[model samples]
Target: MATLILVRHGRSTANTSGVLAGRTPGVLLDERGAAQAAELPARLAGLPIAAAVSSPLERCRETLRPLLDARPGLALHTDERISECDYGDWSGRKLAELTEDPLMEVVQQHPSAAAFPGGESMPAMQRRAVEAVREWNARVEAEHGPDAVFVMCSHGDIIKSVVADALGMHLDLFQRISVEPCSLTAIRYTRLRPFLMRLGETGDFGSLAPRPAKESGADDGRAVVGGGAGAP
Candidate 1:
């Protein structure tokens, strides 16, 4: 089995301002976001991370900068599949204003059936995000062996969607999952099935170290899904 760590990017200027941001260019991480990013290397200090994959968006990239700096030898890659959702007409809108829109109701209660006015559907977003993780999981296992661990830096909604798929929960119910900025979620992929080790863990990880190598057949475990509010 291989371990996959999904990290939501640190807070952005848009996030602090309560803006949707959605694929908009020039949106960088706010000062608080920078502080959050700076804390990652320490949170992940002892893990044997083989690679660091990130969304192509600037915020995601900026969020990953410190980690890369701490581990210069670790390889880094960018994948568009993990980028922020294309919010279409809703892009850059305040969440408070969108609350009055009828679509907002569907997004909160039944995301699987919801589609942005002129943007991508929730189902489509989940499909691509899940597929991207699966591909990376296989690649990491092949190149770094079954015990390899890696990180994926992405957005709030996308992380929630991926978490939903990992737990085999309906996309509509993904609203129950919450992923805060710079939070950490982990999943272990095995031939039998995926095992979710943690979700939305926002504490200091300085004490959390990598597990020792295990013998075969020790991969099976109970599936646990952590819960919270809907995506940002």
Candidate 2:
């Protein structure tokens, strides 16, 4: 097992404006987002991150820039699987305006059964995002060893979906998980099961330090542990 840190890209123009950017091109981080990105290097400075991966979107790429700068030797890779959900016809629409659409209710309450009119079903999104993380987890471990740590910068919904899978929760319940922009969520993978070390952490690196050993009764006797983080 290998550690995967999931990072949600910093706030973007679409975020502040209340529009669903979806796969829209040219959407970049806003001023506050840049500041958020700037602080990430220090937040993650002490971690032994071996590689950096991000969505192809500009927002994700911009969010990863500082990390790359801080770790000049880290290789940056892009994977489309972790990209934002395709909102299809709803892409670029205002969330407030979309509230009137009947599908919004399904999206809010029964996401597992909801599908964007011209886009993907929520369940399908979860499957792909979960598979991508599993695949990368294995690859990183093989390349950098079982203790390797890596960063994955992605979108809000995608990170939430991944978190839901890690927690063994169903897709419909994924809505209950909230990921903030530029936040960090850590997960540790072991041979027996995934351990959620942290969730939706922001503006602090205090918890990023190596976790304390499990107390006597808390030990599960699992080996090959890895760390994970999710940022939205």
Candidate 3:
């Protein structure tokens, strides 16, 4: 069996502004996100993280700052397969504005195969996301032996795909599971089956995590949903 740690990116400008940001370039993490990133290392203190993998996106890379700062010796492996689903024309658009698009209709009725006007199909996204983690798990077990601990930094949808896969839920139900940003999830797997050790648990992988400050209103760092790995 292998122990795996999954982390979603920190809060981005897109996140705070309520934009979809699917495969959008240079969206980057904001100041609060940088602060949030710094807190991760402490949360992961004492944990033996053997390998770190990340999605091939700017947001995902910025999320790696905390984990990398905590473990500079760890090399980051970039995986395109772990990237957020391409939102195509909808990329960088606000959610409320997107609600009226015809694309959402397809997503509502046939989520698994729902393809945005120019976005990726849900089924394809789910398959690749699941494969990204499974492939990494296999590699970790093979290279570092069966008990190796690995960390993965990815996007919200990708993390949901992983949880849904682990729980044997339908691909279309991705929105049902709420994985918070910067939250960490741990999955253990053997030749027989896969088990969830932690689901949408924040402050579990990186070391030296500082407590997040309180927000003015209801927008404090409280978990919004299990939409991603670790939504800190």
Each candidate: what lDDT? 0.80, 0.79, 0.75
Candidate 1 per-residue lDDT, tens place, 103-215, comes to 87788777888888888887898899999999999999999999999999998889989988888899878877767778899999989889889997878543234443221
Off by over 4 Å in 3: 203-232
lDDT for each residue of candidate 2 in 1-232, tens digit (9 for 90 to 100): 7888899898788876667788888889888789889999999988999888899999999999998988889989999898888888888787557767898778877888988989888788888888888888888999999999989999888888899888999887777776667988887788888888778779655434555443111123211000112122
Candidate 2 structure lDDT: 0.79
TM-score of each: 0.87, 0.87, 0.85
Lowest lDDT sum, 10 consecutive residues, model 3, at 215-224
RMSD of 2: 9.9
From the highest lDDT down, the ranking of the candidates is 1, 2, 3
Task: List the lowest-lDDT window of 10 residues for candidate 2.
Answer: 222-231
Name the better of 1 and 3 by lDDT.
1
Report the C-alpha lDDT of model 3 over 135-217, residue by residue, as the tens digit: 89999889988888988998877887888898888876666566667878888987777898998776344422443433211
